[model samples]
Target: MATVTLKVEGMSCNHCKEAVEGSLKKLPGVKSAVVDLDAKTATVTYEEGAVSVDQMKKAVEDQGYDVV
Candidate 1:
């Protein structure tokens, strides 16, 4: 497994946190996703070969957030 911390932007509340976390959790290899609204970041743990950072970024983007 591998873990990554992505700097995310434009999250303002608990709903935003849930949105980001929920989106990441939907990915096939994702083991867990936690979003920090105050820090504006998302930390994700997943099976390394099963998912890519780009795919995770896209999932977050698809939910209207920016992954920097």
Candidate 2:
């Protein structure tokens, strides 16, 4: 497993947090995803080789958030 902390933008509320977290969680090999609205970051734990940071970024962006 591998973990990554991604700086995110446009997250302002619990809904935004849930949106980002939910999107990340839906990805294959994603073990966990937590979004901090105050910090504007998403910490994701995923199986290495099953997913990539680029794929994670796209997942977040597909939900209307920016992974910076």
Candidate 3:
């Protein structure tokens, strides 16, 4: 598995964290996700051959947040 850690913007609370995690977890090959509100970042573990950083960015943006 590969880990993608992306900085996320506009997340203000735990609810935001949940939304971000939920979106990322739904993508194919995603194994796990952990959102850190304090750092404004998300670390996602996914199958190396099945996912990419761009897809992870989309996952974050799809839930109404910006990936930095």
Candidate 4:
């Protein structure tokens, strides 16, 4: 398993946190997703071969957020 912490922007509330966390957790091989509104970051744990950083960024962008 591998873990990545991405700095994300435009998250202002719990709903935004939930949205991001939910989206990431829905992806295949993602073991966990934790979104921190105060920190503006998303920490994701997944299988190395099952997912990629680019895919994670795309998933967040698809939800209307910016991974910076």
**Best prediction by lDDT:** 1
Clash pairs, candidate 3, are none
lDDT of 1: 0.95
- lDDT minimum window of 10 residues, candidate 2: 59-68
- Which segments of model 2 are wrong by more than 4 Å? none
Q: Cα RMSD (Å) per model?
A: 0.5, 0.6, 0.7, 0.5
Instruction: Provide the clashing-pair count of each candidate structure.
Output: 0, 0, 0, 0
Comparison by lDDT, 1 against 4, better one: 1
lDDT of 3 by residue, 1-68 (tens): 88988999999999999999999999899999999999999999999878878988998998899998
Tens-digit per-residue lDDT, 1-68, candidate 1: 99999999999999999999999999999999999888899999999999999999999999999888
Clashing pairs in 2: none
TM-score of every model? 0.97, 0.96, 0.94, 0.97
Candidate 3: residue 31 Cα off by (Å) = 0.5
In Å, residue 32's CA in model 1 sits off its true spot by: 0.4
Show pairs that collide, candidate 4: none
| Clash tally for model 3 | 0
lDDT of 4 by residue, 1-68 (tens): 99999999999999999999999998999999999888899999999989899999999999999999
